[model samples]
Target: MNAPYSRDCGPPPWAGSGGAPSPRPRRVPWLSTLLVAVLVLAGSGFAAKGQPDRERLDAYALALLLLGTALLLARNRWPVASLVGTVATALVYLGAGYPYGPVCTPTAVAAFTVVVAGGLRAALWIGGGFLAGHALIGHWLYQYLPPTGDPGVPWGREVVFAAWVAAVLTASELVRVRREAWARERLERAAAAKRRADQERLRIARELHDVLAHSISVINVQAGVGLALLDSDPEQARTALTTIKAASKEALGEVRQVLDSLRTPGDAPRSPAPGLDRLPELVEQAAGAGLNVTVETVGVRRPLPPGTDLAAFRIVQEGLTNVVRHSGSRVARVRIGYEAGRVVLRVDDDGPATGSDAGGSGNGLAGMRERAAALGGTIDASHRDDGGFRVRADLPAPVKETV
Candidate 1:
């Protein structure tokens, strides 16, 4: 149950006149309260029968039991108040010469509620004081306070009462600790789910950016060529239009694959992911866009991890796309290196700077970096001393163990 509000019914002091109404309070826990009341009253009546020397049961005794039950019903919303109320009623019942039975049950339940509601220190002080005061009344003051000529109780009974109080407090602390653990576990699960969603969003953005950027760059160059050659060189214009068609088709296919994966995640992909194995297609596409590309290999030839291959392909693709859009030179070179448990890729262009052209260099570069970083790799891109641009990436590519 939630915490209690003020006794009077009104909006809180902090709420504005036009603000939302206060949250509805939970109803008092009636069923459990009724059960405890029945048990306490019946058990005391039975004990009173055996303890004939004690003052007989009266209307005041029954009222005390009912009041204790009422206090317990409010325990969830007002634990401290419940603890104080129940403890006071129990003390009064015992001091009035009523025979003890399960009358302390309500106070014990309220004390447990207090500890679990983060009022441990308060429950300890009040509960401890109640036990001490009752012991004083029963052991020393009973001669003057109640049933006349009654003898003072033995010291052993006081020890037993102290033990009962200790047990209740101990049980409350254990339950409090368990509730806190469950609350922490729920929070951790929510945070983990949020993190997973964020990472998936980032991955989707990178995939869409890479697919659209490279393909659009090619289509842009081919369209310009087709427009220039349309009248004088009809055949060349036809070839340019053909390249545009091909580039657009490829972009659409890759985008469809991404969407299909999202629509039915964890299923086998209908098409293979693009990697260094598709380098020849990349080279031909660049040629269609009027930029010549060369591919070179060094060191041992071996298969790369799937993540490493994908990152390397995207890095080279972004690098050449940058060259076509920004560099004055039309020629680019790609170099692939296989070394000790790692693969390296480098793309270069020889150029005089062209400041007028604007492509998505920012998103392209950042996407490449993110892709490399996701696979525990790194990318570096900068201008060459020979007035050219170059992009280099180093990615881990440990060979899979053979069976």
Candidate 2:
């Protein structure tokens, strides 16, 4: 027989095997590459115009510019390596006295990429290296070389170049931090949604177990009685079969009500869930299954929270079902007591336990305890000293306010 509510609460559908989250796809660097290429081409053209040999562009200079642009293509995977290669190419191109404008373009883009990949600390180190290298090579060494008729190192231009590099590095770091923050927010939302779905599934499973277990246990007992009496007494067998049919029909309706609630939201009216008001019908069903049951109440009856009422009803129903199925007992008693701040329930049976249906893993008892605990209540179920089983539950009641 299939268990009513056995289901694996595995990961959400989007999750990978064993509930591990899939790795995020790597972002493409095409946008950055295109921007860098445009800057490199434009800077190279402007620098060539200022060249004394503008009519004849040096092949070596053109080759170095192409090399720097190619290095940027691998920036996403090998950021530090690409940064180093581009910076080195720019230094060599400047030392060759080809042009200065294009060299700064690659250096700036490479520094920005490093900042994006390695964050603020890396930007600081690379930016510092670029500043020191420019001071030593471009400013100091270029002043002594007189072949190109270079005027000299200008302090104003040097200061402006340092500021531009610093601005690019700072902007890259800010953008990287913002992107990381957005990714973290997305992950948090996904985790929260998964948690909600798991909780909902658990609630549905509990409801199904309580509803199906009680109804099916009674039906099984009635059907067994009908089969045995069909040989000896046709009249009693007909009564047992009728009881089985009624129990099965009611069980199907209740199951459909639960499923409908899951399928539709809003205020579509349906049959109300079983509560204390349905306890009489439950007792009649048990009596028809060959168990003599009695119910008694003490103190004034009061309305309860809908959840608490349903839980209390289920606990009682499960207790009676266990007595009929496992205790081999003919007589069962139930008592309800309303007190100052709580409601109490007790179910007891007179029995010599058959042990055929006893010694179960006690999933039914566990379900009862879970229900009680959910409403800030407690339940105790055990074999009585008088050779029977007893289940007692204490449920908290809301305090009344004086006007």
Candidate 3:
């Protein structure tokens, strides 16, 4: 799966300071930084308006405001601490009777900081504290400091300003939260795509493994027998040579498909998958491997349901392969029949029994059973009292109505 954005696409617009790509629950610092910048500009502009006699504009006031604005940059990272520091410094300026510069710019950064990190609840409390502090200072100036330069308000405007502050904080935080949600969605889609790719690769691996694993095992056995009999028995050697040739051909075809998968973008487009019609070829291969494979038809061999054909084909193929590998039996029988709205396949071996072969836990039988169950069918496998291993599968074949 690809990353959310390509290298050519670049990072999103909201990416914050430190070039941190948008995180889920976006921790973007730009909006917060903009808020601080605006407040700094506004405060600087307001402070510039009421200059103390140019002679009295000292180094101390310049030092405090510059330090406060610089501190605001760290707001998102340490909201509570930054807010506390900004609030403390603002209080000192306000206490000096709204001295010659914009005193509330630092407060704007503090208020916005609380909203972004701590959310609306924190904003409410922090905004309330700011307003309360201003009202108290305003009242103090009116009552004792002899009213410095027309600070006018009927209490309602103060309430409205407080509401505006809350709205701006909430709106900015909402933007960050939404960007985070979008990042999460993109990440989830990427993960889901990766999982699907992995599962498909595993399925292809299983198919390639089942196809060549069994065929090569047969070829190995026959090649060894052919080498042993080359000097002692010419006819037997020749027969084994023929078996090796047939196994090699089948293995080569299966390997070609496996390698083709790597070159193809995904599943290769080719002929349809092998199905019931190909069962005869599989049986012939087994027969060539020196197994006397007999096939019988007990019911109508009509066109089967689409999915049923492939399932039936794999059942027969695996069954015959198992017989070749595990059954020391020289003779095997395959019976295909239709009865009671279902198709049945029964492959059994009647030969000398090797205890290891007869007593084995067979994944071939298990896979057939699973396929049968998925089709609303059934499967049964057992060793007969007559010393034969049998596999039976019943697949539903509901007749289609003529159109």
Candidate 4:
């Protein structure tokens, strides 16, 4: 059976795979080309002595230098092929007694490219092959030719050559690992930013739903009452119309506050976020909408973190909105309790679940739950055994001394 493909280990999506042609490689950098050229020209000056003709030796050295430079240009596009060519050319130049110093430069550069493109395994194999070839060839040459200088290629010198190749391979591998790590970090940052944006969008949607749905439901009921009393009693109709006008105006102001916050610059003026201080206004609004609401507070009042305060207010707003819209109750009660390290809110209604209620699919309860969770709080909402719905929330806060 074929091995399964792992996305984590694969190349980036833009890099085609599965036999498809990969994207064109980037052009060779000018700095790299210049470096290669410099190495080749420097190598050409070190032609070995005792050639049959001095001029012919110089020409052969020039030809090898040009070939190495040309091969280096294609290193990135076909790194393995270019590496092989470079190593082979260097070995041939050295074998032909064209001096050893400059010839090794191209081989070192090729070893680096092999490691960077094909990883350490490729570098090890290619480097080992070159080392073996050099040892064999040097042994053969020393056996046949008479010694020109001291110690005929000391073993220490061969050790140094192997070390140079190993150093280049190690450096290339370090760079490749760092580049991959940077790419992975960038991907993670992008994913995190996307998640935050999604959460913000959901929160804003919930705010709009609670604001609009509650106000519209009240306006709709008052408008019907006005229409009905218009024929019998003008005074009551006027009162109903006035109530609708007030509810609409208040809703508009609240909606504008939300929208302005979204559009305003960070340093721009912004309206204060609603909190428990606005609970009385909310209760009055519900009373105007024909639902009797009473609010009770226990324990001492204290300041809260801005986030916790806003979340607390929203939970209360959502709970009361659900009572007004979903529960077919004439009276609702809101109870707020302040404790040593937390604040609690409980909104209960005299509900006998009506078939007209929007039911469990509504976003109001979900929004309340989300708000509480975001503030490291907890919320519970369910129908009571005594024939009413209850929403209870507990939010963390710092303990403050009573004034």
Candidate 5:
């Protein structure tokens, strides 16, 4: 709900206000007393044979009047209790010659309270009770007061009073419902934002885990090999050192790619996202890491969408990482081909693996599959019969424009 009232008014114990601000102040004890005083003055103004019955509303009537008025101040917070007090005061006022002053105000407020708190049904029943008690007692008073020729209680006055009470109650209820609806909408928006944030975090987490885990794993192995061969075979050690350098550089580039995603506004443009054009560099990096990385492209090629191209690049990068980490031999094949209505990619390695070697647990494969599916494509992953792993992705080819 919109914020509640900022301050306390009069600090009256009867003010039952909390949560959102009420249309009226929480406590109006002084207002209630003033209203009661006005009602007493008005009742005292009623004429009996050319002179006002100023003494008719004595101490008893005045006490009932004040009690009923006080109840009005607490109607919102303690609706049922205030309603009971108003009803009882109405009876007392009627028995004591109909104090028309503050008598009706408290009952009217109580009826309104029921309506706003309990909807139309409560308003209807409470209003009906009010009218019945008031009309019955008013008719009795007319008979007992020795007719002052003021014409009996007109039906229009009761109708007008009921209409005024109903209008106030309904308007308050409508405002309450609208406020609640706005609050619910705000809550739904917050929940949706939280869900989107969580999904984004998971996407970034998977990308970092695949890139860093796979890249650093290769660097670690190459470093170990180079350290072992430092004395007997200096040439092979040199080659291992060279491979380590290339892997470290590629790893740094991949890290930079990840960091660029977090740039603030007005920052310089990042390195362009890797796509098909960077396939040659990717293959060379893998070849330097001791895996035979090869590339073959066919058909008429055109510029692909960034998302599609990025997906293709990551699939290749991850597949090559897998080959070096899983397979023991140096020969891994890469293939990229464009054909009718589709672009196909495949990476297979026929390298020998020792008993301790294990292929990936399939997170990278799943990420590739998800990316391909997002573009209305598919992917397949399985082990080759030649004792190696194969990763394949098929992406729908965008129709090229004939310029």
Candidate 6:
């Protein structure tokens, strides 16, 4: 099954300073930074005109405004420094008795950037200190500061500014949460795609294993017989070669079918999948490998779903092929049982284990198990107690959905 995708290997866009490192170096947001600079410069000129009682905007004031906005370029890489720099510039500009309007915009922007970079605590501390300093200078130090005979700023205005600060922090936190959620969703989608790709790959591998393993086993035995009997029994040699040709042809067709499905997954196969209906062919293939297979059907036969039918066919095929390749016995038994709500297949061969066979748990048995497990079924292959090896599959065969 596919899991959610996640990557701790690379950093996100907002990462830096107190946050994660960026996957790639972030480019400066030049246009937006310059726009903020222009707005601050224009707004400060207008504020100076309106507040005739305050110190007029001058070269020093222009330097402060530009410096505050300039710090924004480094906000992503050094958010904590940017926030502190901008906030301090705003305080110096205000401390010099220039009119209050728009001086805090750059500071607010920098603070928001800090929060986005996961420096929430740091932003809070800097913002809190700025507010405290402003309160002290506005209500207490006004007489000694710039414009003469001026009373300090009112408590009501400070309260409003505090509210605005809270709103900026709240908005920044919300944006951070939303960005993280979007990242999580993307990771999940990628993980799901990878999982599906893996399953399809495994399915193709199983199909090829079942198809080639059985056919090659038959071809191997027949080639041996043909080579040995070429001079002594020409007729038998020709017949063995013919069986090899048929087996190879069948293997090629199945392999091509599997590949065709891969090339055009939405198209129907050129041939239907082999089911129990092809049991006779499997038995015949076993015969060409010089083994006799006796098939017995027990209970009432019923139509099966496509998945179960194919699993049943492959399980039986692999079981017989195993007997041909591994068992010393010349005969194998196939029993198909149609019970309540399920179909059972059992293959057995009388054998003292072959020297090269380690209880036959190679790719073929594993493929058989995979097919059965895919359909919520179970497979058991083991050396039988009564001097034989047996492979059994019990698979669910539910009736049609509408029924």
Question: Could you arrange the candidates by TM-score from highest to lowest?
Answer: 6, 1, 4, 2, 5, 3
Tens digit of per-residue lDDT, candidate 3, span 249-350: 877776676566667576764546667888778877777766788889997787788778877877777777777777788788989997767899998997
Residue pair clashes in candidate 5: none
1 Cα displacement, candidate 1 (Å): 41
Error of 2 at 377 (Å): 3.6
Residue 206 displacement (Å), model 1: 0.6
Q: What would you estimate as the lDDT of candidate 4?
A: 0.69
| Candidate lDDT (C-alpha), each | 0.79, 0.71, 0.63, 0.69, 0.65, 0.80
Q: TM-score of every model?
A: 0.87, 0.79, 0.71, 0.81, 0.72, 0.88
Please give the RMSD to the true structure for each candidate, in Å: 8.8, 13.4, 9.1, 9.6, 8.0, 8.9
Quick one: how many clashes does candidate 5 have?
0
lDDT of 4 by residue, 1-403 (tens): 0112110111112111111112245556446655656655653453333222212345776687678656867776777777788778766665555443455555556556656564579778887887777766566564553224212445665676677666667777876677668879999999999998898788778777777777776777678789999989999899888988988998888788777756745755367878888888888778777889888999998888778888887887777777766778979898999998899999999898776744334777888888889888999998899989999999998875669
Give candidate 1's whole-model lDDT.
Answer: 0.79
lDDT value, residue 158 of candidate 3: 57
Clashing pairs for model 2 are none
lDDT of 5 by residue, 296-354 (tens): 77777777778788888888888887777777767777788887777888988885655
- Comparison by TM-score, 4 against 6, better one: 6
Q: What digit string (tens of lDDT, one per residue) describes model 2 on residues 230-296?
A: 9999999999999989888878988887776676568564888889999998999898878898999
Question: Candidate 3: which stretches are off by over 4 Å?
Answer: 1-43, 50-61, 90-124, 138-149, 264-268, 296-312, 335-346, 350-387, 392-403
Winner on lDDT (2 vs 5):
2
Deviating ranges (above 4 Å) for candidate 1: 1-31, 356-361, 401-403
Report clash pairs, candidate 4: none
Candidate 3 vs candidate 5: the TM-score winner is 5
| Cand. 6 Cα-lDDT | 0.80
Worst 10 residues of 5 by lDDT: 1-10
